[model samples]
Target chain A: TTPLTFREAPEYLTDEKKTPFDAVAKYNNFYEFGTGKGDPAKYAHEMSVDPWSVEVDGECARPGRYALEDLLKPHDYEERIYRLRCVEAWSMVIPWVGVPLATVLSRLEPNSRAKYVYFETLHDPKQMRGQRSLFSTIDWPYREGLRMDEAMNELSFLAIGLYGETLPNQNGAPIRLVVPWKYGFKSIKSIVRIRFLEEQPKTTWELLAPSEYGFYANVNPEVDHPRWSQKRERRLPSGVLRPNWMETRMFNGYKEQVAHLYKGMDLAKFY
Target chain B: MAKVIVFCVALMPLIWLVTDVVLGRIGPDPGQEITERLGIAAFQLLLVTLLITPLKKMTGWPGWLRHRRMLGLFAFFYAVLHVLAFLQLILGWGDLWATFTRRPYIALGAVAFLLMIPLALTSTKAMMKRMGRRWKPVHRLIYLSAIFAWLHFLWQARSDVTEMVVYGLLLLALLFIRAYWFGVSSLVPLRKSRA
Candidate 1:
């Protein structure tokens, strides 16, 4: 098998300069390793991520587990630098390398009954200490879901790697979902399952706090969480003194591709 | 000797926290770091405060009580710095009214800070005497402030809850010891001995 060469494709460029992946990888919101920004980068090395497989089932015509190698072998990897915004008011631009999610889901062959696509992360408590924590409000086997249309969006990527390397465990090593336009949690990490469902599937954060985290966690500056403001987000590698933070943009600046998806509905209510 | 060493060691994190903030290493949101440092300082002070009774009871260390006021005041000192950092960095005076009115988390933090004011003001012996019996009740609010402080930390956290859990356990242990002491004193009678 030939070694796959992934390349970076800039989505949003400001004055002809692409956003750096260092900015994206360094400033992350992965809590499984720890709470701090740097904690994930430090502690995620402990994760054992090889020999991975993803199980596909539910409303799909063919239901079976596929090896990570076999699943990734077909696609030509392209690095698309995307603006990632967290619900907690922070943003980063990541250069992600993967095929479009639609391209991957098309191979699964979803039936007419498939209305939603649910994702699940690996549930090994031995490797993931966060799973063992009793105080965590989130249930084990962190799960996320998307509407079938949302899953098939061109903007969504079935990301296998990031920052010009194979995925780091902290950033969901081996493979993960990257929905750039949505809030950070919507992009589930270390995915092991992709099940097509007839109904709207429950998500991890939404299950933890429904009012705070919605199923459609699109980047809407107008919709604020009960605890904090969404109007601004600290762009990471946060410098000292004034102007460290940036004004948050709607749909994480992917309004061209995604804003139409939420046209008729009220975002504030859904948020 | 061990107690003094432990007390000094606990102060190390506080020292580091301050030095890091001054050196501009705590990132853009120094307020969050300040809050975390103060919370840890407060917890350590509370632990030290609880240790006073145990040391005095078990080892006949009467001098332990002398350190209580200092430890309690240090806790308040860090807490005040935490509140000021939040005001200066996060809530900025221009947005203070909006934050106080709109954001629930800010209100929770503000209430916690407000509760600490009376405790800090009456910490001196002169005010303690002037306030008389009210001092005890006023100081009791520290327990409530600890709860608020924990909640403030818990709510501020994005996803990882491990740090909050550790703090919660420490607070629980200290509260448990106090409850056990009270329960034993109230329920059990002392035996009379003839010389």
Candidate 2:
């Protein structure tokens, strides 16, 4: 693929120091490739991203398979340097190049019945070793979803590239969602299918552990993960001697932009 | 020579970790790398310390007991380092009080390490002699420490319990064998075996 052309979007950018491209590219949690932080960087190259097609169906007026190029054609890509926080309590400020997910979904004409937007990652056990692992509790295709309003949120993004280059397979090649306020897992990787649903579709992690991984995995330090504290996160490239710990913010510090979306709802219950 | 070799082998993980740290090869998150390595080393040492008794009983070998004290102390050493890495390198001292109060797993790990202190301090021959009647009972705290350590790891396990499960099974097996032997040794009269 030719180098992606994207203009820097000032609104989407954060003043936080961007994590080095090497660390962003090398450290990943794309479990389809493998579970280890470095496994995706090592094995993701084996999975083909070219000749990719996204199947958009369910409660959408235009339900069909769109080639990767066609999906990205109408939208001009923008570089969004957003803080990417993982539920595992590690974070990085990543400059992602993509179109707003709302722009893409609006073009698809989601019908009035569409209450939620469901997504599915590419499934091929031959390519994704984790899919074939007997130890994994996740069902294949790695499904995820967002409530319709959440899907339409301005901050929701569809990232195609990072660091002014085409995204490495380890960091979700071809196309992936970038829900900055939510945990990284909510930003599904290697998308192959998207469905506008009438009901909140069950997500992969939520299915594995409903109590821990709820559908709306917005970054909230107030609510702790069942196993560990969410109060703070270690910024990537942090060393033993020179630690880089920071207090986690509500909505990952995007509360001003996204707080209205969850106004009166009890976050702890939803979390 | 055997003790020296055992000590060197036991120290290898820390050496490798320090080398990795100095060389900047400890991956993207050095704090996590150091803490995990030290924690796992402590756990592995704890398992080894438990294994010595079973091996000696099975083989009727007295030589295995010679290295047990050193192995136990090394376990305590790694455990202390693991705690330090978390408090100093990961959480920082400012957040230590809050983290300890809120996080059960971290508190449990601290408890496990604290349980090792008396065992390590009393490991000396002179101290063991002075506490002769109570030495065995006090040293039995290692069992409680093992339980807490395992609990600490288990409570922190997210979805992938593979590592925790493996460690837990090994611990259970070691404890079970000792429990079984404890029963048999009471029935059978003690006899000095060929050294």
Candidate 3:
């Protein structure tokens, strides 16, 4: 695999004012750096992202540590303007430059028993001080899982860059997952390992607060978060004093594409 | 001069928030930033208001009591700002029913604000004179209001409650001191006489 390049996005997707690169780069939930909004920008400099490798194993035909560059060589890339909605009720319209995760997963060649795709983030406490800090509430080496079909969705992207620049450290440097329909946390960051599983992997958030955050965190305005309303989201790159809040769409308005996957499942229960 | 200084000090955060908004210094989500800052300012001012009584008792300074009304009003001021921002910016003053049903933390914030209304309206010397001995009992609502304020903050946190725990401890200590000073200790004048 070799590094892929991104060009112009489709015309229909370019409507929202692109989130200023600085804001996207600066404001993030990469808790690996620290808990505060600006902490990542302040502490991410210490995170070395170059010369990284992702380990692929479990239920796969070819399992080994693959260099970040070689992993991307075979796939075609595109820049898609996506509305990145955070579980915290804030959202940003990002122009993400990357290849589809489906493209990569297919290349890995999952065996007959590969029912689920499990992902894990880097666990180094030295680079990520939050891992070592006693105040952290989340379990480190954060893990997430998606059914094989969900991972193969057309919308499931493996992001490498944003605003045409290589993925910034705070925005999950080198590589990260981008699942537009699901809440942001479902898309894990700074992934170090990926495995094929027959059963669902216990995600970090689900273990921490099961009732609050479900495994399938599909964005639904009707099913409000216990603490805050998801009915409306502050679409970012908004005015400083007054943000224009728009009614949140079910599946963040990606219903036509991804809704078929969860046809009969109780959304409220899954949420 | 101290009155003006205290007033300015309390209002400085609001001023900075407005100035930052104009300059585009706040990040992508300005609504969230403004809302959180207003809420925090309200909480901080309310906490400071509680500090006055203890500080006065420890230092034997009656002057602190004069600024107590202004300080409490500042807390209420921020509370009002916080709610207004939530309504105008976050909720768009739309679907009030939906907001009430879906999000309970907003209710805690609203209840805290409503509790402060009477205290603010009665802050004037005229109302204090009008209420006479009843005024003291009415103003005791601040303790409950402060508790609501803290709960509102604490409930919104998903996890990592280190800061909220600190505030909770501070509020508990203040309430404990008040209960001893005014509740049981006031009636026990015998102890003061013996000392």
Candidate 4:
């Protein structure tokens, strides 16, 4: 399918009324560029993101390397205005355009043993200045994973674009994962690989600091990160003296769609 | 001579902050940006202060000792700005209980600021002389304050921890250098006795 044929469904546009793109772009937590919210917008421009390829491997029947163009060409894009909550106490409403991850994974045809999906980013230190720093705790070629069920969830999107434009390099171009219900980091950026595995796959943040960053990394306000409280978040681009900056909702307000995924399990423990 | 230059250098950020505010370039929330900048500056100055003794021991830079006080006071100055910014911008001096109780990051930041008050107040020649034998022990709280300040920064950064981690590593390196110096010196005395 050509890019012109890609259109957002009416349901997605209705959601956009409640959550705007300005809030989404202004209130972001993209650390790859720098720690500041504005850093992504400024420094992400330095990234050489074209000529990207995503390698699909592990237990999949048709595991092979696919160029970004080929991967994004087949799907009809839809806008999803998701409330993105960071593990830190902050949030934003993002209008992301992409195909459902379930739709993409179904085409890949996972083998019976496939229990989890792993993702990795490009490892070029020259292009990614963050990778050059030895002081950074995050390992180079940042990685993240999700259980097979989580990967197949309708809420999860293999996002290709945002705000009616192609994904900015700072916002994880050419493609990124978007698990709207989970904390922002669970939505890994600049993905170059997808692996289906039998065992629970190791994620980069969890591997770096397991005690601090749990494996699930789901958006459960009750499960406070060891260092800080997750109960509340500061909305970005806050006016000089505006009180009542938007309040954070449970599961980043995707509870209606995804709360059932973790039913019967204790959220505090999984968190 | 170097001490004076170091003191002036440390005040550059504060000067830039005032200029930014005056130029209308401080964005809509000048107060929050100022508070964050000042808090970060205080932590950076504290990290520099913590490095003085280690640098003196390692490189025999006796001049480093003279600059330590100035750097420490700069840390206190920026900390004052940080607290004032929070009060004026975030708290607004109304609803005292709500201001103090609602946000835990504010509390963590306040504790760090409170701890520094004693250190800053006692940083005078008169106070140091009056305290005499107790001065060294009291000044040791600077180390604790630095750790608290680091924790405050870490806690404030919810999702994007890159800045906090950068500052955290700098503090760690400074602390590590001190521990290494102490370990080496203690080992030297034992070696000399054996010899």
Best by DockQ: 3
Give every collision pair in model 2: none
lDDT of 2 by residue, A117-200 (tens): 999999999988777766566778889999999889989999999998889999999899999999999999999999999988
Task: Judging by lDDT, tell me the better candidate of 1 and 3.
Answer: 3
TM-score of 4: 0.75
User: What tens digits encode model 1's per-residue C-alpha lDDT throughout B1-195?
Assistant: 755765576577678986896886675444555656666676557556656766787688787777777777677777776676666655444456777888766677677777777777778989989977656646667666776767777777756677788888887776567557654222221222121
The whole-model C-alpha lDDT of candidate 4 against the native structure comes to 0.73
Better of 2 and 3 by DockQ: 3
For residues A126-245, what per-residue lDDT tens digits would candidate 1 score against the true structure?
Answer: 777666666666676889999899899889898877766777677887789999889999999989999999999889888888878999998888887777778887665454334346
| Number of clashing pairs per prediction, in order | 1, 0, 3, 2
Report the C-alpha displacement of residue B136, candidate 4, in angstroms: 6.6
Model 4 residue B175 CA deviation in Å: 9.3
lDDT of 1: 0.73
Cα lDDT tens digits for candidate 4, A1-271? 1132366666544332333444454434566666666666677767777788889999889799988777765446777777667775555567777888888887788999999988987777667666665556676677889989889987889887787677877778778999978888899988899989999877877877777687787777667676545666655544454522445567877788878778898877767
Model 2: TM-score for chain B: 0.92
Model 3 C-alpha lDDT per residue in residues A87-158, reported as the tens digit of each score: 888888998888889889888999999999999999998898777777568877889989888899998989
Q: List the global CA lDDT of all models.
A: 0.73, 0.87, 0.84, 0.73
Model 1 bad stretches (over 4 Å)? A1-4, A10-27, A34-38, B1-11, B18-31, B101-103, B129-134, B154-166, B176-195
Q: Rank candidates by TM-score, best first.
A: 2, 3, 1, 4
Order by DockQ, highest first: 3, 2, 1, 4
Which of candidates 1 and 4 is the stronger one according to DockQ? 1
lDDT (10s digit) by residue, model 3, range B61-180: 889988999999999989999999888777678779867766677777788889999999999999999988767767777877888889888877665676788899999998888777
Ten-residue stretch with the least lDDT total in model 3 chain B: B186-195
